[model samples]
Target chain A: MDQFDSVVQLLDSNGSVVANSQFTSTLSQSELLGFYRDMVLVRTLDEQATALQRQGELGLWAPLLGQEAAQIGSARAMQKQDFAFSTYREHGVAWCRGVDPVDMLRFWRGTMHQGWDANHYRDYGYQIIIGAHALHATGYAMGAQLAGRVGSGEAEKDQAVMAYFGDGAMSEGDVNEAFVFAASYQAPVVFFCQNNQWAISEPTRRQSRTPLAQRAVGFGIPGIRVDGNDVIACYEVTEHALHRARSGQGPTLIEAVTYRMGAHTTSDDPTKYQLFSDVELWRERDPIKRLKIYLQTKGILSAELETQLAGEASALAQRMRDECRELPDPKPSSMFDHVYADTDINLEKQRAEVEAILIQSMEN
Target chain B: MAQLSIVHAINQGLRRAMDSDSKILLMGEDIGKLGGVFRVTDGLQKDFGEERVIDSPLAESGIVGTAIGLALYGYRPVVEIQFDGFVFPAFDQIVVQLARMRYRSAGALTLPITIRMPYGGGIGSVEHHSESPEAYFAATPGLRVITCADSNDAYWMIQQAIASDDPVIFLEPKRRYWQKGEVNIEANMSDALNMYSAKVLTQGSDCTVIGYGPTVATCLQAARFAADDGVKLEVIDLRSLSPIDMSTLVESVNKTGRAVLVHEAPGTGGIGGELAARLSQACFYKLEAPVMRVTGYDVPYPPSRIEDDYLPDAERILDAVEKSMNY
Candidate 1:
């Protein structure tokens, strides 16, 4: 467990550089600023989504309140061809993948299960079944290996796959099976675990006696632990892992040590189980706050820039709210669509029967 | 046309499908080298190479969940579950993930996956090897459950299932794997009846006997025995269990005025129960008696010594026919 102990961090909580950092020289000032901006934007989106849920605009919302860097940094590390399988809470990752915030709300509003086409963004939609997508990512990586799209010497020609899950998901059978298959096949995939401290009222300790990253060694896969609040560390580690996967070095396990500042979901009440002190302790290591501090200390953040970003976030949130309100009600017949690539005669008959019953009820 | 066992026919069907499509791959435990416990996949690995005919690790969920990923990546993966009872470990992946992906994605993704499992009893296997789990899969909304009674359908349906855009649960009767029948190698894909349709194996006028998978042969035998007793019985092989070819069943029941449903699964809440209820409603005016079902008792499959007694045989089916005639 201690082999990967040193949590790779380029920036400390107080916005000071750690002298022996590997990513400090690699990341440019503008790119660092961009990371900071993206983190703040995602945090703002999280807050708005939570507020919408409270007001009944959404059925539920899983807030990515404190794990912005873990999601954004790793998501930004992927090449255009690389694919990601995400759990439902990775709103930060979705934002980084260029999925419009409003489009993500359709599912929460009960309009549809998936709000966007996975093919359009090269990223799978939110997988609600915990840890299931890990196997999917491993299998997709195997497919890439078979297609001669993986293990190429050139990075551009190689495609790597990534799966995002919470610490709780490490205990799931699907995730464990994924580890076995990924390692045995030497699949070109990365298992990104955001150890966000709490899974509904249960802490990470309840799920594992050892750190999650150490579990990778048993599967014969290399594991890396990083300070999730440090955006630079997250980006650097993810880029290195993805490069290894692309170059056919096989899979990597990344455990991003982070905290969730809010309830697990809109319906959850963290005050019932977690201590306020614990939340306060994590508040000091806020991913967005640390990056903002780093940008300010570097003379990259100005008063005018802060005001402009705040305005942009508010405008985007407002547009999302308006669009969500105007979303059309679901049609009963639409359920019959897409059940199969080609609907058979029996399904068509059932659909018609349902339509007739619905029409009869409406007329009466 | 040539005489072949159901096992060899399936092997030929698999080989033909793989030969035609580069994206078709096979994965299962012991399927590559050992040629499956049933040897249904014999020589496939040698002919197709280990890459295409992969011998997967011994995790059922891993087999199915990874197959989902492979399907998403544009490969039509045909996974063998080894046996009927072992499929439970993969039940979550099949019921929750593979069955729901296309509907959840709203057509954004299609899983052309074929999960083949040797099902049912009478070969005297150990515990957890003889369960007929067709009802559980047929109850699932997004899946297509299919079973074959002869070498011809076994050969054709395996290829059709691989060609289908939807996920299919292809159930093979383990006890009937060696049943010999004629297989037409020249049959065209477009000409064969859609795999979902039922087949009237024998025509008669006195009564209708409906069965699928393992019980189809029993019903055919019952019909042959009924012939000597001055009673002609119509035997219908329900090829597809889910979107059950109701038209054929309704027509048969309409003409016969009585129908007998047979299955090896437990009687209560079985496919027989569902078909009996539906046929009663569909053939209400034409029926002479209640739709009768000759099924295994609502109990766990017993020891191999009494396996014939546990499973519905020609006698039990004939008894049901006699009871229906009296009604």
Candidate 2:
């Protein structure tokens, strides 16, 4: 209805396009197949992680069961120099960024401070405080804009950022403040909200009266609602948004209308609140399945290639399951290391006390 | 040396830092147009333009969180958390993100962020305005906490604080913001006393009275009053609260065997307790008394009329000195 005139096509659950778009030619059969494979791999990893927690291997797991396309598609669309800030539920995006899926267990298992090395992937560590990273993305974008990093002629010279959060994060005071700051500064960044409808117990309806994307209009940035399960839709939207940012057009908020097909975390039981039928309805719209069907219909995927991909994905999942089970719990004294860079008397004293306790426990 | 207030001193430090580093930024509520409630950040927005001096929304957490991003991008952001009471809202961002960012990155990333909070009581304002929250940060790991007793210390210490590569929680004594002193504007910022070392403001043979921020003035006054009573009191200003200036404290406690620690924060788990424990270990042999303390009672800072009772006054400090001397 808005800007990307022919861009917002709603692909039906049966792999038939109910509406069409001019950007369809922008994607090739190989890219479409690649996106599907990534989604399937992520979904497989999410399932394995959930089972790992249930089997007492991990302390917790945030299953990105349904929002795989929104994360993987957008993550693959960006240039390497462009940075990313993600909330806790961006495992799929982390996978696209080349973060070891097993490393994420280190944080949930309380074995490490963060999932992976931040600089390794330019993935600024996963933020637990909802929407706090949104502002960081805004600030970094403003910094990039100032250094003449935006519209630098060379594609590598243009740097923008993408901030990912959920519907629950939209209600946070910091997220709204990020909107204000981004708008005022006209910082080149994309505020990507995977509106998966539930903030633990609360739904998206409770967080916003209008749609989450519509709120971006108030910030003077363009907003769009995309078919989140549609991998092509997510990639096209994110790529175009990044282009606008690099062109110094400022921020854009994309509300990927997806669904959470699994529990919020290993500790949460969605059965306590949400209806099971809703999950079933969304499962039919599984991002991987739609893409697979589209690929199969287009004769882009052969049974042999699909079997090989699934086998590889399954083997990777098994290795993750095995590695997570054998992963060592952190040494108790290591907790003091990250508290401060310089030696602190109070922390040293506390560490000594903790060491004494842990040693005593070991003797028992 | 031109005389300037602590407010002006901090203003000079900010101006100098911004002039030195193009990446240095100043942000907070009313820090832009209205300067600041205390005018410590006054004239910054006008001098540096809006990008360098930002007037943010009323959310403290947002200010600190975004500041972390700015720091990650190689900008040194100096934030003003209007008052002590308002710091709690940003405690999550400051402690969890800003404080932990450097360590989380394993020294790969630098968070040269300075959080300037106008702290301590005594300006006779409404509730939540005059509270001593330094101990909270002092207990928090990964944060370097520091405060100044006077304008000279404020001018040099603030620049030193901003220049540090680590995140610093800089506490400004609101009550003493208007106190005037000689601040050599031309003096090298790092030439003053070491940031981690405490200073012996006054020397005496009787007892050591330790305090910082607004309480340093009160402690000095108490020392003077004690002198009238024939009690020669030594005063120590703890400039750095976290990596505490223990050497100066140990030296003084050993010289003056009897010691009295003072602060406006509650008596329990106060900086006084931490100092007492350290000095106890460091100067146990020289002690003439089980170190005494004069501090606010373990209760919320009360109304202005009752704040006299809640905050340790010079009389109470002298009383503690007498008690320690008696022991």
Candidate 3:
């Protein structure tokens, strides 16, 4: 068997618990139920967003249909002080970070370039450029170290940074540079790569010959492969890496092996490139369904709990539908604002000229 | 006040800013013990320690990308690009991320970062070491592009760039690094000349000659040559490129009714082209001839032996000035 096949999995696809797993015994019943709820809610949000794009309400949407466990599990592992840097498709991560569902749509709706305060949520806004934010995350971790926030021996005081990227981003030079910097500086950062097996039309094989996690060994960091569809394993693996970072042991790379079950985006036709048979096979190992089955088998999920979750998901979807359409178009003059923190005389004059033209046109 | 070279003056400026603000950090390759390739960051690491004066890995993108992160974390980072030609590796981080962070965040985030790059040609150096890349950055909206010609401006402008809340691209004339001039260290930073405004280096009534960075010295030499010929030429140093001091240029051109722009970069898509277009529009009625340009040939920066022919010099500036004056 391939070394990549030996993923850290606590819950099998049939919903049976693996015996003698170090992490499985640590997770509480409440925590397991919480993960299930989060997975279901984010899936519903992803579906609603895709539908919105199809209905012409949004410019585009990158659906996170099957990678719910990978995103939510890793995000939930982060402490309050820890920061997260994500790609545009980490809507599940954003949900876990408490980003407003409507605010998340602003970027896709073309209402704003960025929709949330990155500092407030401890989540760096979506980075459209692949693998760019990894360096930013590494730098932020270095800052945390300079401020004496790492290896402080206090859970609430010490902090680590989480950098999220997909398998396609593995080929980018910036990402490799980020890894080099992180290792050289012993920066407190966890590199979480969700190997969704597809970089749009390209497969994982196109990006790397070996497992993506194995690349970390060349950078002198511990590499781990986790069953991305298993939320328990994903959470535990990320938690371990975050702990290592906080303790000043340096960075770790986590490759969550998952599949992208949806089109790359609303504009992409996955049927043109991807095999339907492969999609059918992945559907059987669905992240949410397996978690749901585990929760039912453990008797942690009740009829009342199911009803409550369904209602909450529908309400969240409704809120997204209502607020997405009602988003106000920004004023033309607002484009000139915040280009520079200080006064730029030339830019101000250009803004004034444009404003005058706009006023004259409106009067005519 | 003390006499200092442009290199030492910038070193003192960096020292002054780092002394005042604990959050200010210096990051680049060979910047710590090595004090940088030009020794501009000399004695900084020994005094401030390695934490503040970081010796980054020899990766331009990594240096810039990490600097942006440090700025996001509320530290003022001063990054050094070893050479002008090498800045392209970090160009995406500089242009896309560092420049647009504040605008993208709607003022919620401010990156008080200064990227110090020693630019322009004329020094005896190989390929990739001598190239003027200021035009690519000046055309970017969110960045503040400024350059220093002499020792005094180098002393004050570096500190000013570091203090600004927006990201600044500080271009230093590499050939003028060893050129000595007086620096008023006792002067108050607030009382210093406005960094965005252009200065009249030499007063004249004939054609106005404009240049910046390395070309400023050439323009001044040409003005002196023109004076020897009894054809007086006014010299103006364009300190800032992006938010150009057009008011000063327009006033000078209106007085002289002729202008000549000079730089080491290629003519097409250079700063000179933008200045010429703006000057032609601003001084159309007051002009005697078309606003002329004495820029480098639209070709790659040549080998060391032939760089003199490729670059704009005093004679080239004078030739353009003579053309404008006669026209």
Evaluated on the second chain alone, the candidates' TM-scores are: 0.99, 0.98, 0.99
Model 1 residue A249 distance off true place after TM-score fit, in angstroms? 0.9
lDDT of 3 by residue, B105-196 (tens): 99999999999999887764445567899999999989999999999999999999999998999999999999999999999999889899
Rank order (by lDDT, best first)? 3, 1, 2
Off by over 4 Å in 1: A21-25, B1-327
Instruction: Report model 1's TM-score to 2 decimal places.
Output: 0.57
lDDT of each: 0.85, 0.82, 0.87
- Which runs in model 3 stand beyond 4 Å of their true positions? A1-5, A20-22, B1-327
- Candidate 2, residues B244-325, lDDT tens digits: the string is 9777888888998988989989777899899889889999999999898877655455444334445667867876787888
Docking class of 1: incorrect
Q: lDDT per residue, candidate 2, A163-253, as tens digits? A: 9998877867888889999999889999999989877645677567878888998889898887788788888889989999988989999
* Model 1, position B216: C-alpha lDDT score: 91
Tell me the tens digit of each residue's lDDT in model 1 across B85-143: 77887999999999988999999999999999999988654345678989999999999
Poorest 10 consecutive residues of model 2 chain B by lDDT? B301-310
| Residue A351 in model 3: lDDT | 56
Lowest lDDT sum, 10 consecutive residues, model 1 chain B, at B297-306
* lDDT score for residue A69 of model 1: 90
